[model samples]
Target: MNTFRAARFALRAKPTASFLGRRTYADAAGPSDKIRLSLTMPHQAIFKGTDVVQVNIPAETGDMGVLANHVPSVEQLRPGLVEIIEEAGSTRQYFVSGGFAVVQPNSQLSVNAVEAYTLDEFSIEAARAQLAESQKIASGQGSEADIAEAKIEVEVLESLIAALK
Candidate 1:
C-alpha cells in the first residue's frame, strides 16, 4: 500500500520551472487576462486585463518593443531588456538572454530562456563584473563564434543590471 501511494504521488506531483539549474519559480507569477505564459518546467503565467503594454527585447536584428495583442509571431531573443505593463498600471522591465518569445494577438505570450527573473532580482555588482568581461572580449575580436557568445552574455548581464533600481 505504501509503495502504491508513493507511485501515485509521483505521478500526480507538479513539475518545477527552474532557471540554469536553480529553481526559478515553482509558480513564478500568477495568471493574467491580457497575457498567459506557459513555461516548459510546468508552470503558467497570465497577464490578464492589460490593454496597452510594451515588451522590450533584444532581437536578432536589434532591440524591439511589442505592444498589447500586437500579433502572433516569434523571435530569437538576444541578451537585453524587456518591458511590460505592471498590474499596478506601471512599466515593468526584465532582463532576458538567449531565449525566444511568443506573441499572440487575442491574448497569448510565452517566453523561454536559459534563465529569467524580474528587475528586482538584479544586482549592481554583478553587472559591473559582466560589463568588464564583455569589454575585454570585444577588444580582442576573438572570433565570430566567440564574439557572438560574448555579445549574448553581455546582453543578458546588461539586462540584469538595468533592472537594478
Candidate 2:
C-alpha cells in the first residue's frame, strides 16, 4: 500500500500552461524583464535578492550573459569580471576570484564566491606591485609550494588588471 501510494505521487501530472495559476517560461522571461540576483561572498553579500536587468559572468566553459528565465544550470566561474546591469540602467563591475553560480527555475541567480570586490575599490598601483612580486617569486628558485602559491597569485592579479582596464 505504501509503495503504491509513493508511485502514484511520483507519477502526478504537472500543471500545464492552460492551468489558471500556472506560469510558463515564456511568460516569466518576456522581453524587458528582470531577474532576482544574489551575489554573495564568504564575508559579504553584495546583492541580496535584488532585481536586476542582466548579469554577465565569467564561467569556466565561457563567458555568459544571464537574463530572466534562463535554463536552470550551474556554472563554475573563473577569476574575472562580473557585470551587473540594474533596473535603472546603471552598470556595476566586480572582480571575483572564483565562484559557483546557480540559475534557478524561478528566475533567481545565486553566486557564491571565495572573494569579490568592486573595481573602484582596487588600486592599480597596489595590483601592479603585487603582480611584480609574484612574478619574481614564481620565476626565482623557491620551494615548490611557494612557487605554486606565487603562480596562483600572478593569475589572480593578471585577471584583476584586465578587469581594471
All candidates: TM-score = 0.53, 0.79
For residues 38-153, what per-residue lDDT tens digits would candidate 1 score against the true structure? 32212423333334334556667566554433335677877666666544678766565567877654445566666556666767887888888986786676998888877766
Give Cα-based local distance difference scores for all models.
0.54, 0.80
Over the full model, what C-alpha lDDT does candidate 2 score relative to the true structure?
0.80
lDDT score for residue 102 of model 2: 93
The most accurate candidate by lDDT is 2
Per-model RMSD to reference: 15.5, 9.4
In each prediction, how many residue pairs overlap at the backbone (N, C-alpha, C within less than 3 A)? Answer: 11, 0
